[model samples]
Target chain A: MNKPTVLIIDDEPQIRKLLEINLSSKGYAVRHAESGKEGLLLASSHFPDAILLDLGLPDMSGHEVLRQLREWYSRAIVILSVQNGEADIVNALENGANDYLTKPFRVGELLARLRSAIRHSDASTVVQTVETGQLEIDLMARVVRRAGEIQKLTSTEYNLLALLARNEGRVLTHQFLLKEVWGISFQSETQYLRVFIAQIRKKIEDDPNRPVHIITESGVGYRFQ
Target chain B: MAAVKLHPFWQFLIGTASIALLAMVCYALGDSMDQWAVALILLAAVSVLAVLFDIIPVLAAALLSALLLNIFFIDPIPDYKIRDTESALLFFIYLFIALVNAVLTNRLRKQEKKIRDREEKEKTIKLYNTLLNSLSHELKTPIATIIGSIDTLKEIDPEIGSQQRMELLAEMEIAGNRLNKQVENLMNMSRLETGTLKLKRDWCDVNELIFLVIQKLPATDTIRIRFEPDESLPLVKLDGGLIETAVYALVHNATRYTPKQTPIEIVTTYNKENNLLIDVLDSGLGIPETEISHVFEKFYRLPNSGTGGSGLGLSIAKGFVEAHGGTVCVANQAQGGALFRIVLPVEISRLHV
Candidate 1:
């Protein structure tokens, strides 16, 4: 079997070096590009299995790159950004990037995120059940269970849980979630999403205050692990 | 114009005296001028006083002039008596003129004060803009360092010497750390200014917090940081993300101010009052006595300190801590160095774990 390949687009040499050394050691072929233009050209010619993009590129913004890539490319594209830059991360995710990692992240964390992003994008099998930390959500049956206990959830609650479960490790933004669970007109009703999420957390999380199954990305959105 | 402002009392004394002198002049020139004409001249004098003095003194002058007109320049001079119907009417008319002058002048003065207030507000907005411009300007040094180093590395034709290569990389790391610090400070300041900082209060373990923040600090081996968590410490409910940034700024400042080979210690304890007290103690030359008060002020750099910082770190720390209903204090330790403390009020239930 051929080894999976990864492409990195970043202006900082140190970040590119870190990604290259770490990704290469994990048995994946790695390619590097220093600017947005070169990254787009190399991505077309090489068609790497996964792409790591930095938002602060010199040639073009990371949002612009993601927008152009989404027109044709359909593989996993994980964004890299500085910490507390929630707006940019949300924009990238909304622009069809699968996942994101803040800079200075540990190598293990990056590898884990890359693995999840690549797996979900190429997932041909329709998942019926999602399980994390003893919380099992059966999408096909519209059921939720904690350990062996069946959780009774409202119809709205079930839909929200099912949506987050299906997109497992990806950060779904507030606007996207509101539109998907509610209608397009409800995109700006973030308070509704918050109330519903609190209810869902009480049902699924062991300690709803410190949730593990459904984690909040603060101002961005939620990530179901 | 050089503003020769008079005290309100002095203005009142001068205005009333000037009205009295005008009344005396009219009394002396009584046969030459009509009583009604005298009233007109007195009203004009009161209006001039309103233009030059404060409202209180101007209003007082108007009333005094009317009283003087009645007492000294009336139909029955030196007596509070009206002799003829026309003269009584002229005296009342003179009094009415003074009252009208005060009212109109009072209204005009209030309008002028309102305009001045609006101008002050615009000045404040302009100052904020200047602050923002200077902040962006402060970012240029680190950016230049990063670009200049990269440019040098790129121009190398042959295999770069390993020692020089490592130095360049180290320089870039330091510059990147400085750049990131400025960006973090800028974001936190904007968040505070815009009121967009929403506290996400979750259970926070002090042990894990210390580990995470230390790991996140710029890669450095020079200054040693030591902390041992209290085994019985319970999880405090607060915004872990914000508190982490606050603590990072404090410790980061210590790293910059303290010299090499010195150690920085962080001690977290649950106080008797049920507040979480965090003390970051550093062994170095303590902050100057004069600068202690101004340390938390935004962009207030110490006059003699040659450190390169945006001076927003401490202020942001104080702001975040305060947002959580907490207080931050700094004091020069008696032994040496500075002691920084953060006290956060937490729920009573969080204490027993």
Candidate 2:
């Protein structure tokens, strides 16, 4: 099997080095570029499986680079930016970046988000139930079950659960879930994400108090187990 | 109201009229009067004109006095020639005396005016300093409260879930305390700047004052305050309430920054030479090295420091200390933490009522 290749375009030498070491340790081939100009040339010529781009670049912006890449290639683009404001995050995701990560992000969290983005690109599966032991999420038939019993969910709740279950075991940030499920503008509505995630857990998880599926990462976002 | 002149013409006319009157008096009275008596009258009249009219030049007064004494008061009477050698010698003597007096008085007045101008400038600068320091210090507390609470909320529940609702209420309490501190600083700053920091000075026990400060700290149980007063020292005369406020600010700052586990040391010692010194030391991230110089500067937060504090703590402490004729200094300790030393004069007479 060919190695899964990832391209990283970040201005900071330390960040690029750290990502390269961590990603390669997980058995992925990693390539790098220091500027948006070099990133564009590399992405077009090399055609890597996915690209991690920093929105703040010295020569050119990551938004422009993402726009240029979306013009031709149907490749996964994840935006890694230190610009943590709500509007900037929403705008980046709206401009066709598949995922976003704020700077000072924990190494483990970033890797989890990367896995979800990669899984999303490789297999675009849209059918049937994803069951692990007591939990069952049937996407095609539009039903969810726990411990061999059917559970009811709202249309929004069903959509949210299906999205998370489809990419289960990969971390989904608050911004990513809101953008994917509710649209780009809902990225800043953390309250909505929290309330609905609670409602879903209450219906599916054996103990809502100690959730086994959806987990909250303080000062960061959420992830599904 | 009279119209004020833009030109010097009115001033020149006044000078000319005063000079002509002095000349007429000398001419009319010169022959019957002794040369000394006539010159004395002319000198007196010129001095009055200089003071009253505010336009006659000192040089004009000297010149007019000299011409009158030489032409009219001399023995020559109405003639240009002197009656004798004695008369010519006396004429020069009177002229020299009058000229010397006028020049000395003018130089003295100039010196007095310069001193008066400098004193006024000093007064204005002092008032400006008080106003600026107080205003910045006053605004700092509330702004810190609002920002700190918001940051805490973001930290505790980025998602704002039902389980973390209790944390939000506690965050609001912290913010409220910050706002209250700010309003108090504003009121104190205004009262102090207006020359109204009236001390209700009395002979009070130093230990009680220290205890009062400790009572004001949040989570008071966590802090270990050590107040050691000298046994040989006499009872101190101070504004008990004001000094307590100053000590409260110091203790609060020390407790806030110190690791929740570290002990705080507050000590008081009396020196025969420098009077009394009280030191408050904490083992927190000491005021940053750069901020040590400006800890007393109003509203100046240390670079890269936490945003929870109002930045007015040390400035208000300094104000209260200085108002009682005391000196305050801050520095970081080598072992760790910050030390604030306040020196107060043992001699109570140094404080202004």
Candidate 3:
């Protein structure tokens, strides 16, 4: 398989160099764009699997670059900014960013988020069946089974469960889940997701109160094993 | 001393006005009122003037009232001589009481003013002491670590393993970051104190903000943070930078005080009243009742907690939230932990679908 391509847009040479060294060593192709304008030009010419953007670019505002890139490019775009503030992250995410990581982040963590973003974008071509312990979900059949028995699930519950199952072992943020299952209009309606999750947990787990298949990440979202 | 000394002319004018007013009222009511009633009315007027005016003015009012009582209300009207013993005793008592009331009221006012001034001075001194104490420790520790590690790396033998060298470098990095954070907090506190912070308002998603806060925090294996986002929460208009820093400060505070492996839960919700609520709760030792009120005070730390902080975290958090017309408060959870809640009143026009 050809290595996944990553575009790095940042003004800091040391950071770009560090990322290139680390990402290249991990069998990934890395490209660099030093400014927002350069980044836009390069992105239009040759698309990468993921674009790592810096919010504070020298030529133009990083937010503006992101806005323009998102106008056409639909693939994963991860933000790597030094702002490290909630508003910056939220704005980037709302503007169609797949993931966000602050500067001085651990390479291991960054790699994981990158892989998740890439997987999320390429989810259509990935595996159709997800299995965790006693729980099995067959996306092709639209059926969920536990302990070799088919368990009945509502369509909404199935959609919620499938979204969580597809991102196995990865945390699916609440906003992402709500957007995927209930549409963008219902992204902030967390109670609907919680009620659906509880129903799914009840049908699939041996003990719903002490769930094993679905885990709650508290202030975050949900994670499926 | 000159400022404190009242002008005799003005004092006389005030005293004469107060007495004249009382005399006029008494004279008007003398047709229906008895002598004793008139005397009591004069005494009450003297007491009221004593409470409202300076000591000199009050004393003058009292003397004038006493002289009127003796001249008009005595058994022999308009006579300086007193024929009866009871009448004489009453006149003397009235004069003594008026003078005593004036002096006592003035003394009480001065004492109250002194106590208030002293309390204000002590509060300021305490705040400065806390700042200095925390600053000395917070700044010196990071600087010392950086210096010590760098000195070791420089003088060490060339044969040292690269891994060891890398470890030292990491130590320096951590120290440097800690120092940077302390300085940032100090600057933020200064901005809050000097009222120089400008709010850059934007629509904010609470869920994304919490995730970023968790992501920005150093990856910890021991402390787990769970964020439950409200599905129906509307995007709130806020100074996103300030609110983010405030929330980060609260979470950082919980991490420092809470024990390892304890869960810190951040939950967000929105009500019909257009207020966004965010709660950061920790399942650790709860704050003592006595310290709960002071938790957000500038440079105030829980006594003997031994946690390393400049005591500006919560204060800055509070300052930032309040800047957005919001309030941040802390309370001990019933099940043993601390709960910090931030309620921001958002404008409905700023909420987008």
Q: Candidate 3's residue-wise lDDT over A23-137, tens digit each?
A: 9998899999999999999898888988999988889988899999999998888888653354576677777787777776778878887887788877576769998788889
**Top candidate (TM-score):** 3
Model 3: residues >4 Å from true position, as ranges?
A: A81-84, A131-135, A145-153, A167-176, A183-185, A198-225, B1-136, B143-296, B302-307, B313-353
Better TM-score candidate (1, 2):
1
Q: What is the DockQ of each candidate?
A: 0.07, 0.01, 0.03
Q: TM-score for model 3? A: 0.56
Model 2 local distance difference test score: 0.71
lDDT of 2 by residue, B57-168 (tens): 5456567666756766676566567778778777776667656665665566667668888999997797577656655554555566567667767786667776555665
Model 1: clashing residue pairs? Answer: none
**What are the C-alpha RMSDs, in order, of all predicted structures?**
11.1, 21.1, 10.4
* By TM-score: ranked, best first: 3, 1, 2
Give the per-residue lDDT digits (tens) of candidate 3, residues B1-353.
11234576776687778777777777666667666777788778776766666888788888888888787777787777788988898889888988998898888878877888899999889878878888999999989989988888888848678898898889888887888888889888888889988886655556656755776687892238887656466666676667878989999889888887789999888877788888999999999898889999888888887857788899999999999999999999988899999999985433332
Tens-digit per-residue lDDT, B78-106, candidate 1:
77777888878877776776777777776
What local distance difference test score does each model get? 0.83, 0.71, 0.81
Off by over 4 Å in 2: A123-127, A131-134, A147-150, A169-195, A205-212, A215-223, B1-353
Q: Compute each candidate's TM-score over C-alphas.
A: 0.54, 0.39, 0.56
